[model samples]
Target: MSEHSYIAGIPLVLGGNVFGWTAKGDGAFAVLDAFYEAGGRMIDTADVYSAWVPGHEGGESEAVIGEWMESRSVRNDMRIHTKTGMLGGAELYEPARVLHSLDASLERLRSDTIDLYYAHKDYPELEIGQIVEAFDGAVQSGKVIALGASNFDAARLGAALDAANATGATPFTALQNEYNLVNREAYGPDLQALAQSRGIAMLPFFGLASGYLTGKYRTEEDFAKSMRGGRAQQLAGGKGPQVLEVMDAVATETGASLSAIALAWLVRQPGIPAPIASARTVDQLNELLEFTQVELSDDQLARLTAAA
Candidate 1:
């Protein structure tokens, strides 16, 4: 099996969770168009996206992306990274279930091949060898180019890697987890070190701390603006404001938006190449895109790291 890097030239993976949920139809298309026009190459989506909605049954985001790609004729120029094993409300990581979900994802994305396919989360109850073999089958079948593990702890990830090595199955090439300025415990030093040692690319989701790091959700009243405000509310009572203060200082020093500083800090981490974030509008996307141009100094990064 050949090892492949999932990231292209850009250091941002556009999150597709907003599509068909908060941003739909022309709005979703506009954001996607702006992202690609700004040199974004990868999009992160899952088959279970928008399932929490009242009338939705998931795959809505993938269908929107599929239609967008078909309409824009930009399939060849873009890298689509999607996840499975998190839907169907059934047993997770079953070999047959994994393949079945993949086929459904492929159908929704309107693509025969996926550049990168991720297991949405680790199922420790399942044998690592079984998971490895299931994902490896996709690679051998030319359905998925690379395999990734999301929301996996360091020890479990290491075990999965060992299982792959012993069985000669394709190993995970990327890791996706809840990593950001305010939330560091999940993907802390141990996990970062493991990823670096294993050469697994890190693409952290919730890179903006669910909008708390965006400087828009400062006071309790700010939570009233979005449906996901509860997440920001939880951060408000803790170190969220303190972390924002450090980000504010860095933003002032670099003239970058709070979103950019947050993402820039993520990119500077040891094994991270990009951070996954979503924008409901072109304006929000522009703010996030600024991170590509902003460079944080060692001191600024250190201060942010220490404050969080």
Candidate 2:
């Protein structure tokens, strides 16, 4: 099996959760266009996106991406990564179910092969062998180029890797987890150590702490800036404001936007190959794109890490 390595140039992975839900079709197309025009290539989405929205059956984001790829005709220049196994209709780790889900994703993305396919989350109930067999089967079928895990803890991830080694199945090459200056517990020492030891690329979701670290939501009233305000609300207390304070200081020192600083910090973190962040508008995307060039100094990183 070919090992999937990390790509440079654009360090941000555009999140597609808002494609058909908040941005709708046209707005999503505009955002995607701006992203690609700015040299952004990696996009992250999932089959279960926007399912929490009322009257939505999911796969809405992938469908929008498919249409966008059709309209833009630049699929060759871009890398698309998506996830399965999170939709609520049924459990997804079963081999038959995993194959069926991937087929559906391919149809929606209008792509023959997914550049990276993630098992949306770990399923401890399913035997480790079962997960490996399912992913190995997908790689063999050419429906997925590589496999990854999202929301996996260190211990479970280790077990999964052991299973892959013993069975000689397709191994996970990447990881997706909630990580940022504010949300650090999930991907802290344990996960960081495991990924570094295994050489698995880390793609941290919520790289901006759901926009809290973006400096757009300073006060409680600023939470109305987006529908995902509840997430920001969670960061308002405790060390959230403290983390933002350090980010603000670093942004000021480096003359970078808070959003850019937040993402740049993730890029500097050990084991992180890229960060998965989202933008609902072209302006928001522009701020995130700044991460491509802004390099955080060791001192700035130290301050942010110490604060967090």
Best-fitting candidate, measured by TM-score?
A: 1
lDDT of 1 by residue, 143-261 (tens): 88899999889988998899899988889989999888888877988988998899998889999978888998886678887798898777545888888888888888888999999
- For each of the candidates, the C-alpha root-mean-square deviation to the true structure, in angstroms, is 2.0, 2.1
C-alpha lDDT score of every prediction, in listed order? 0.87, 0.84
User: In candidate 2, what are the lDDT values of residues 13-72, reduced to their tens digit?
Assistant: 889888988887677888999989987888899999878899988899999998899788
Off by over 4 Å in 1: 1-3, 88-90, 235-237
Clashing pairs in 2: none
TM-scores of all models?
A: 0.96, 0.95
Model 1's alpha-carbon lDDT is 0.87
Please report, as a residue range, the 10-residue window in candidate 2 with the lowest summed lDDT. Answer: 1-10
